[model samples]
Target: MHLTFTTLAANQTHYFLALCLELEKQGYSTSIISFHEESNKLIADAGIKVFNVFEIYRIEKEKNLNIENEFSALLSKYQIECPNILLSHEKVTFLIKDSIQLKEKFVLYFKALEKFFNELKQTHQNNVVLFQELGGFASIVSSFYVARGMGYDNIYFEPSFFKGRMFFVKNTFESYKVQENFSLPIEPNVLAYLENARANKTIVIPKKDASHYQHPIRKIVNTHNIKRLFQKLFSKYLSNQKEEFNYIGSFVYRHIRMLTNRFLFIKYYQPIPSEKFVYYPFHVPMDVALTVRAPLFVDQYYLIDYISRNIPNGYSLAIKEHPAMIGVVEYKRIKDLLSRNDNIVFLNPDINNHEVMTRMDLLLTVNSKTGAESLMQGRKVICLGDAFYNKSKSVRFVDNIDNLYKHINTALKNNAPNIDDINVFFNSTYSQTHIGELYYCSKENIAQSSLSISQYVKANYGK
Candidate 1:
């Protein structure tokens, strides 16, 4: 059996390597299909076969044939549409004007992956793919399509309900664990962990970038992005030119937008803590939660319009800017876009998340962890996206704009938090989750994570 690691970054390479090495001890041949050159060398150093994209890129160039058509057909066949938000984001300005370059890059990527696929069939036995996240980004999404099309089994490792724990799911957008007779988490330690997290009211920011953005100055100081600084400055002055350095302009706009949001938040978005409100914790625009799972709900402003019109008379719609996007979007711009009649109140992002959840008359989310966390509190949640907790009776699922009003009324009027349901969900999640943290975990935690991976493989694929 070949354990092929298809991880995203060089930072995660060590952790993926740890799993591969542990499995290697059990008669499994190890391989890595990576974009990072350093990761290729590291895997090779560990006596694992390395399949780097540059190697395939080299092969493609030597072919002297433009395989862009073939690559486009493959992407079309897989229905792989690169996220539109990428072209506009300032940090990674790969896609600006002439989306042709973006398409060309992905075409070559898929072509390299085809070469790698051919090699996998000839050199490996019982091959399987491992990914941290699929269907979220461009290159990774391309890899997922290529691998799945070639008839390989994939384990899409997902973050479990518990922080630092993980579980296997078929897809990121539509995964729901079906288990009956729910009880509290079987592990005493796991239960304690949840209790502590709830008591302290810690918000789990999904991406490392988001956690860093909490303290923007420290994030900037630690980051060696001076090159981007100049790029942002020059892109603005060269706006008349075709998208050569538009990322520079976009970058400059992003920081300026952040400052603007801070100013707007103070000036216009002041929400009295004592007033009745319905919470809608905003999400990172780039996340799969919105882009992949809830594409229609991508425009929060539209949903806000619906909520503003339909919410009960006394309850104000309190929306918080997603911490991840605080530095990216202009909050004042969002506020000014709405008419004065839209009974809306914007909450400061810095406020304790649990306080926001607990105080609100109702918590509405488009597939956020806020929904799950709210449910754990026995609080009724109005979920707009397909979420793990949508099945809970306490959660009101809204699928259409026409029905959102009815659903909100139903949830608000009759739904009360069920402590028993919360306990059951919590227990089931812990009992099923493989104990370990995915990133920044201690050595012991890594070992436990590897063991969890091994267990899943043994249970599902082993003879």
Candidate 2:
């Protein structure tokens, strides 16, 4: 099978190239359709056919015609009339869609992609598969559009870990073997592979760098005045509303008491007091809600107030700031609500989520990977909203703050979490066992979904 990879981001490098290299080693002809000059250079340097679309458009004005015409030129450059299966990055496709206009520029790129897909359909016909690396609404939408264009029944979205530098070498090899033996028309087979593939994976390298998040050090030096100024400026341009700075100032004042506990310290590495409290780690990117005419921050504050009124007199709450959004806003509203009752504490952090999870009594969060990690550690995880990991029977989710006191009473009264249950859950979600051989078959999998020579011609020439 032969494969073509088309992508635009000059700075971003994807696993498609590596996947192509592996396929080539297994005796398949692999080529690249690079959108950027730099990427074309890299592909050529690697001794592969490099279809430099950007350069072609630069040098030839005719190439600037409808995207379909430019696409035909690109296909001709690569000597591919049609391909068996055409694979491109979903994110890049969406970025291009959003970046271009539908009249001329959009039509041009669409034609290029359509030509590529049509060629695949003509050459390979029923063998085309569109793959999504990051499975989300956007990825699914992108796949739907591409599948419609190519008339492909087989569409697949693989796990994020199985791509890039982090993919397990053994797993890829095993998948290759399986694909070689597997029959054609692989939609159902691919779906089955995805279900089992999750548990069959190994931790080859630590997950991609945790450095992608906001630094924790910013919390210490960012005083109330600075944060207030930021709040004013943001409210003017981004969110034209005033933040209650005084409330936050008072809230930070009370957090100074956490210093009493040597082991319970927050960002400064202090200790936490052995007090019974509910920990809520706020998740962000909710600011996007404003675009849809939603008042997200206000709703969050109201929820915090409800929790403050309902929690029992002696017990308290702990709120953790999202690592991504440290200085922009504070959990002061939640803090002030709890302060009226003197039962809520906000934890500052100098470290990462792994360390924070270890120090907590119970984790209360929304849909986050932390929910999964907490369950893996056999900790009490309470999810407040719909997150991917919330469907577990092992984790508790509080939908309403009105029931917060009752639930806490019930949990403390019983606290019946089974170690065996935790072990079973962990094994189901993360444990890597038995299916180590599957990784070796990765090449076969690639080949099975790969496009053949004849398929490319039909997709492009509208045969």
Candidate 3:
């Protein structure tokens, strides 16, 4: 089997590489087709064949004509034959554009891909189209249409989170001992443990994101044609505290039941603590202010300076660039912006957001997933604008520089949130099964096959 992984950026390259090495170890050949130079270098440095799209030679030519001709040439080179498995990385923005325009780009890209595969079928009929974590709404819906139109039978979709019984099964068995009982979901031992934990409030970690809101209801309200009508309806209905609490209360009930009743507990839950930090996660379309549509301009550096200069002398600010934004953001520009502030501390790249937020006293974010996670972790999250979790007392939503400073000061003295409270917030909102179920896959098969890959490679290809 020949496997090829396609990507523009190398954000999830490690995950793809792990999958590829597993395949190669199983006596299969693997290669990477990446558009970025950094991606190619990383794969090649790991002893994998890297097929680069545009390189030094391609860059030598003039801009427009060069990119057009080179892109065509690159496609032609790969157009020879289809591989057994072709996995596409998540769709990334080639350039920033309006959301409406971005949707058009997505449509065109998929349509072009549809045409490519339609042609590829003539030579190599044995091809599978696999997409990694349908990154966004547009991409997911687009892939569904493309896959159906092309009639490519081998289609696989998986969730990107780590939640479910299967999750703890593989993890617990791996930690303790693998057993046949672990394979079954209705494990009496596990249920008893989880029940006990819930009763004692021992397992106070965060719940899934969707549990924080009525996502489907919100989606309908936001996406419907008559926005004004729904806005009025929402305002009227939500205005009543009883109605609103009942609405939110019912949402939490489902997750609380599922978690306490279904999933088993393990003794290995990671601990999180309270500390203070300035978190600037990388989000897209240049100005996150636009995407977030917040009432203020969220200049991360400005926020950092204000915090460092005004937040007294006792608090420490942890600054971290989004893991995915490492190459995208010019760190030099950011460094230059913060050159005057000695109080800013950059976090280690490998630090998990979950762990970091748990220990942090407060999290400062514009509109990032970390903000949502921070809210769920029961940390005092100070949002500068309309983040997903901007509604909580644990969260202080500000609209401008001066207001941000005001709220930051307020948050410092506000009530501390316990982990159980965080759980309640998350449980009362989003649907747990939507994204959580996907993360809880049975990875035992993947792991066993992966381990066998190295042995198989040595047996077939020699040491």
Global lDDT scores for all candidate models = 0.65, 0.43, 0.43
Tens-digit per-residue lDDT, 1-463, candidate 3: 3434444333445545655666766655665544335455578888876644333223332232333444344335434122111111111122223343333333344444454445445544544333333233233333444444555432222221123311111100011111112123343443444345434433222222233233222332354324534444454366421111122332233334323321121121222313445455444323323222432343455555666776645666676545433233344545664467655666553456665665677777776656765665456776665443566545667766665566777777888666544444444332221222322223554454344333433443353
Report how far residue 72 has shifted in candidate 3, in Å. Answer: 28
Give the TM-score comparing model 3 with the true structure, all chains together.
0.39
The candidate, 1 or 3, that scores higher on TM-score is 1
Better of 1 and 2 by TM-score: 1
Report the C-alpha lDDT of model 1 over 179-242, residue by residue, as the tens digit: 5345333567756766787788876553333444554444344445665455444533553221
By TM-score, how accurate is candidate 1?
A: 0.84
TM-score of 2: 0.50
Instruction: Name the lDDT value of residue 268 in candidate 1.
Output: 56
Candidate 2 regions with alpha-carbon error over 4 angstroms = 1-14, 27-40, 44-115, 135-145, 148-207, 213-273, 284-312, 323-343, 351-359, 384-388, 397-412, 431-463
Q: Which ten contiguous residues of candidate 2 have the minimum total lDDT?
A: 171-180
